[model samples]
Target: MKFKTLNKNSGKDKLHSNDVIADFLHEHLEEFGDPKEDILKALNYVFDRGGFILLGLENKEIVGAVVINDTGMSGYIPEHILVYIAVHHNQRGKGAGKKLMEGALKLCTGDVALHVEDNNPAKFLYEKVGFTNPYLEMRWKRKQ
Candidate 1:
């Protein structure tokens, strides 16, 4: 598989288009996925806040993709948050996701963090990649 990263400085003629990347995530992520708009927003956020979107390609098709955003801080928080990662449904259990994650992690200068639903099998892969759950996440959403 070939890996390509798209960031703020990436040119217009990237190997894969943002639409392809967003569609791939929305499709492969299944029940754990967010809407395409949110994915697109995250993809755009990388360019605004300094991060990269990594794409895993094989046979000229996108087999997996990972979106990571630099949190712009360290010590008290991880320096990067892996926002999304997904491998094509037919490509699961074939190490494409792992390779994508590994490649994404390699691009980071400090600690990386990601959220996984408790029942999501991908949690195992995250743990295998050296991510530990050290705290329970609590959030307060503003009422609309």
Candidate 2:
């Protein structure tokens, strides 16, 4: 249940690779079908642009992860977007997800935002972790 910032050269970062991330996504996508390449692309973009935070063992096995970005749109006040959050199926009921989120929130300088589909069961967990429903957005991607 230890938490650490994934250093570039650290063994922890090795667990954050595309293959592992994709595998976790694939396991979840069985009900959602294969996700588009763009999804992985977006994940890579977030990893690069948002600075990823991972939750796992001190030895390098990742149990959960969260990606966040600074939304440039400015007006009222605090701002940031929680681009993605995922807890490995094996680690779901445990506090890995919440610990990862708390780590993300601690690093955030302002209010954060994220989208969750109405049908996602994780929505309940999100709410339990203090996220609120703000609005709805849709995605339209043509089949490859």
Candidate 3:
């Protein structure tokens, strides 16, 4: 599979748009994904703040995708947060996800991190890709 990286300056038309990438992730991430709007917001963050979007394509169709957002710092926090990663259901087990993960990791200059639920099967893949659970995350959400 060929890999494509998109940034704010990438062409706005067709497959280059954040809308397209968001749609692709929304569909491919299945039960593990957030809503398309949330995915779009994250995609926007990469372009507006700092980060990147990577696409794995085979025969011009997206087999997998990744989004990484730069934390804009180092040392205390990971330099990047792997915001999202998903492989097309039909493409799973074919090394597409692994390739996407490795490709994203290779592009980053500093440490990268991601969050996964304990029961999410993808956690194994993340672990296989060298992500370690060094700390337990706690979040306090405000009532809407």
Candidate 4:
């Protein structure tokens, strides 16, 4: 597998690749509503926020994906946050996820912050890569 970075432009332009990454994340995390448009909006938000995507590809297929978003003003010290990561269920045992994270680390200036479920296997990969601190991942729940 090859890991590559998709800048904001390519991430937004490549619809098929975007869907593969977005759908994987949606199925694994279940963070968004069951609507196609919602996924598009989320990807657009990532692009608008100056985030970049790291993708693990095999035979031109997206096998693993990671999204990194930087917070704070541009051109200075910013906190890079790992927004979402997903490896195709069939591709879990491979090192695609690790390669994606490593790629993100190479792109960031300092330590990156990300949160994963206690039971998620990817947590082990994060710890293996030295992200061994506790962090809270919080989000606003829109009242229905």
Each model's lDDT comes to 0.88, 0.63, 0.88, 0.70
For residues 17-92, write the lDDT of model 3, one tens digit per residue. 7777888899988888899999998898887888888989888788888999999999999999999999988989
Colliding pairs, model 3: none
Q: Report the backbone clash tally of model 4.
A: 0
lDDT of 2 by residue, 22-140 (tens): 56655644454246464466456544554444545535766665656666555563467765677777777877778878888887777877776678776786798788766566689
The TM-scores, one per candidate, come to 0.95, 0.69, 0.93, 0.74
| Predicted candidate 4 versus true structure: per-residue lDDT over 76-141, tens digit per residue | 433777777777778777776777778878888655777676777778989888887654556999
lDDT of 1 by residue, 12-126 (tens): 3355777878888999999999999999899888887788988888887998899999899999998999999999888899888889888999999999988899999899999
Winner by TM-score: 1
Q: What CA RMSD would candidate 1 show?
A: 1.2
RMSD of each: 1.2, 4.0, 1.4, 3.8
Select the stronger candidate by lDDT from 2 and 3: 3
Candidates ranked, most accurate by TM-score first = 1, 3, 4, 2
Clashes of each: 0, 0, 0, 0
How far residue 9's Cα lies from its native spot in candidate 4, in Å, is 5.2
Candidate 3 deviant stretches above 4 angstroms: 9-13
Candidate 4 TM-score, C-alpha based:
0.74
